[model samples]
Target chain A: MILFELIAPIVVMFALSFLHADRVRALLALSAFAIMLPAVQLLLQDKPFPLLGDYLIADRLNTYVLLLASVVGAGVALALMTLQRHVQVHPRAYFRFYRFFALFWVGLEMAILSNHMGLYWIGLEMATLSTVYMIKTNATRAAHKEAWNYMIVGAIAISLILFGIILIYAGAKPVLGEEAMYFTALLGAADRIPSPFLFEMGFAIVTVGMFVKMGFFPMNLWLANVERASFYPVAALFSGILESAIMVGFFRFSDVAKIVNFSHLAGFIFVYALLTMFVVAFLIYRAKDFMRLFSLSGIEHMALIALFWTSGGTFAALLHFGAHAFIKPALFLSTGVLESQGRYHIAGALRGYRGLKGKLFWFVVGLLMLAIVSLPPSPMFFSELYGFGSMIALAKSGHHLPAMIAAIVLLLFLLSIIFYRFVELYQSMKYEGEAVEKRVYGSELAALLLFAVGALALLLPFSLAFLRSIA
Target chain B: MSAFLTGAFLATLVAALFATRLYRLLMWYALNSLALGLLALLIGSGLNDPALIISGVLTLLLKAGVIPLVLKRLTQRFALTRQVTPDIKVHYAVVLIPAILVFTFYLAEPIGRMVGGNANSVAVAISSLFLALLLMMEHRNVAPKIIGFLMMENALFLLGTTATGGMPMLVELGIFFDLLIAIVVINLLFRREEAVE
Candidate 1:
């Protein structure tokens, strides 16, 4: 019975998907927020919310993620409305669009909530499949190629995850049998699970597979490719919400690793995090499109957040993730406004407008860009400051070499190259071109302002007692 | 018995690697799935595990039986060329396959010890995984690549059965369900809208 209730949103989504009416889709999304609230509330009360079959259990770790994902959905819906105002979405395309939208969220929600690793694998794979259509929303040749690339890589990564799952399950067979595959049970008996080395090795593979799902470093080619070709809202979905969800999933693995050979797992994560941050930060200067630039910078921050996770900066990391969640979508939505103008280059896009109205529009863009770079007063500023502190502390504690490489060396490169390139882009903007300055769509402005306010609000210290000790 | 089952499984993968005819590739998959089912059955009998037997039954019926039929019908509908156009030359693939199998045998030693299973079986399964990846990479068309994916899943199933005796029944059910969905999605994706046949 509890299982049925847990799947009720998916049921509702499938039923509503056929409607294709704006009102029905809005209602469907709002209802998702409604259903997710109880789970979040359950976590807030410090109570375990377990489904009947033990397929899913809600803990504090996932509660924050659930709340953020729910909000990202609503925010993206709002942004989509803003996009719809300019681009003529065919009435016929509505059903498929909304169906994929529903499928993406349902799969994501399921992934976040799944307790069984196999169930989680299914959920993430389902979400990946759904996103293929969303990425192909534009239907251009480039869109097809990007979506195809994304699908191929995502499938390969998921296959790797499957192999990892089998290995770990097999490793646990002697001590725990099949129950060894359940995360809660496995974590409880991590030390007792036979062949601890096998478990660790399998988990290492799973962790790497997940990184391929979420980031572009080492395999750093696809994130910008997919985002640059996708419609902005789809870009926002994958970049802001979906990737964050995967991070939270990885966080759970990290959380469980406290019981499973913690030092090795922590060290492994740290190396990857710093490596990704350094490589992507240098590559940020090479971003061709403005959207790709935003994505590359987001990757840098993602690496930083992963770094925070590894360095035991739990609060600062979650804070950074939360700040990024708000700032990224808003940035994407606003950028959608510019990209929707059918221009190729940032200079060309900027050249399509003129006058005071254009300046106001550019102001909005600048605000988002500044917020993303963690410029002062933006909550990212504080979150990032805390991250720096955490890294410094980590360096002082004896692992000075890697920490210094991440904190000082790559940090210098990031600021000089990425941020400076951003400034160069800022200076290149022109308010004089072919198209006239247009009034900001109300929904677009509303979403942007909501994001701006959310970014500011993230600065206010939410006393998360749970994360206090982890630091 | 396990060695024979694993060997037959690996042979099917090797056969698929060299098979040019599209129908022959599907046959290799069917034969591969059949070997995996038989392997599961053998393990189930040896361990007296009903869940393994149940998984064997499912694999035999759905993967070995139903899926190959579906692929056949799909080929007929698409009117595709009978032969697979692998990007890699045949002679090169033959060399790569054996090299991969040898490398994985070395690679599987540590993992095999950890599981305390039939080391050769585990080694064979691991090698099949890489070989399956090669098959997937070799294909430019969607069908062969998906067949390659299905083959990879078969390899994992063999690993699970041999290493763990068997995974939990619920996880197996979920895995099979996911495979069903994957096949449907792959078909739909290839067919585009208004799927024929």
Candidate 2:
């Protein structure tokens, strides 16, 4: 039953590619909703379910990610359904877009659910391959360049990850034979593995590959560059679903690292997260294009999630992950509508829009901006609060008082810069352009509203408790 | 036999680093992959591992034969520049290459001891990986970079085949699937580049 549910979307989307564009869009949205039913069932189940004689496992972490993927996936598909009417893509191209999107989704599922490390790597590579073409959906020169940049970086990262996986297998195979590639087996025998040094090196290499893929510090520009050039729906998925899946890979491998007494893993993640946030914060401040601003903000959010995860704040980290998953797609979807109506910059762009729909657009963008900045009533507020509290606690426990305090102060200052920049961009919005009336699609707004509601609901006590329990 | 094959593999990768023309570089990659495939077969037969044997066959058919054909076709179809010169001059790379090979041997000693595998073979595999990365970094043109990326995969497959015998058959199969899809994507991007130009 579990296997069927997971495979169904890939099969349906592949078959639907032969149909016309509208039907593909319709069925894509429909299949996303359909999958949510099983995702919820999987999420509600208590015990881990192993399949294919243990090659794949549905456990708490992956199930939680599965549910998140479903929700975000559905929202993006819905946004595509509506946003397609405005964008002038060829029907053949549109059909192909959804087909690749389906493959991307399946790849995420495979990556999240696979118990074997090799399978996980393959899943990530599959996802990367699918996105390489999807980024070039517009066929623009800039789009092709970004796609090429994304591909080269992605291949390098994937190759490094493969090397890391091989090193890990070499370290583990001595103890557990062929079963060493399996996560459960590795975790179970981590303490007994004779080659701790090799394992640690492997884990470190894997983390570096993931950091490169996730756009940490030095390699951070690829995500922003690619996202800016990509079709908006694709950008939404890049920010929302792809980032979440990559982090899931990190968490799975790091789980094994932790068991093996790999002490440097946390410090490694913290430094990169800190550096990434620092870079992203400045980039966000200077972002002139709306998509670039939002993309930079996505990097910041992912960095914070990594920080929270490493700092003994699993609950807060997962919550932030969930909240960002919903919030970013909403931001992209709303901004996409604005772009479709000829506004894609941070300068006084509000003047170009008029009417109740225009007001709703500004209002949606404002609320999402607030949510992203972790303002009150948004779940991010609590996530950041708890995340910081945990970071300080981690510091105290490790007796790195001065260093931790300094890091926290720097992070706080960066956050303020980002928040202040968002405000400046918003305020500057009121000062420009000749007012042109625009009609916003109800379906687009509805998709945005669905995600907005999900973000807000994540703030509720019940949702917090549910997320904590999952964490 | 294993050492000889690995040495040949390393030789092809080194030769690839110096190739100044498109066809010569692709020929080097194909030979590099052929060496890796033969090494996998030799090790698999010695270990009596059917999975490793299958992986070797697949590697030969796909990496050594099919992928190069596709890349060759892409170069022809796109009329991409045939005279390839890496941005990092050959003189500098000549110095850098031997340094990497020596350093990796030192680095892989402990890993080889831990895995109970041949330290020299592991070192060769690791060095080849670094050399492939250097190959990618030096090239400014797209075809050589793509070949460099594929060479990195060959280097990794060599590492896994030598260091751990081979990964599970399913994982090896998946990697091949990814490689095939990557070629399709590369072909698309080449077409797009030509269109843009």
Best by TM-score: 2
lDDT of 2 by residue, A72-174 (tens): 8888778777655767666777777878888897788888888989988998899999999888777688888889988998999989998999899988897
Best by DockQ: 2
Clashing pairs in 1: A216-A220
Cα lDDT for residue A143, candidate 2: 87
**Residues B4-105, model 2: lDDT tens digits:** 899999999999999999999999999999999999999999999999999999989988998888888888888889999888787888888999988988
Off by over 4 Å in 1: A1-9, A21-25, A32-36, A348-362, A399-407, A430-435, A463-471, B193-197
The window of 10 residues in a row where model 1 chain A has the poorest summed lDDT is A462-471
Residues B61-117 of candidate 1 have per-residue lDDT tens digits of 999999999989988887766778788898898788889989988877787777665
What DockQ does model 1 achieve?
A: 0.51
Candidate 1, lDDT over the whole model: 0.74
Q: Looking at candidate 2, what is the lDDT of residue A367?
A: 79
- Model 2: lDDT equals 0.83
lDDT of 1 by residue, A1-471 (tens): 444544676567667867777678566655555545554455565436775467777766666666667667767777676565666555545556667777777677778877887777777877888888777666566767676677777877787777788778777767876687678888787778767766776777777878888765677768778888877888788877788767866776676665777668757876787678778877777776777777878788887787777766788898888788888888787776666555454653554445655565566667777778777877667777777777677667765657465555666566667778776666565533345444466567666777777666655555345445324
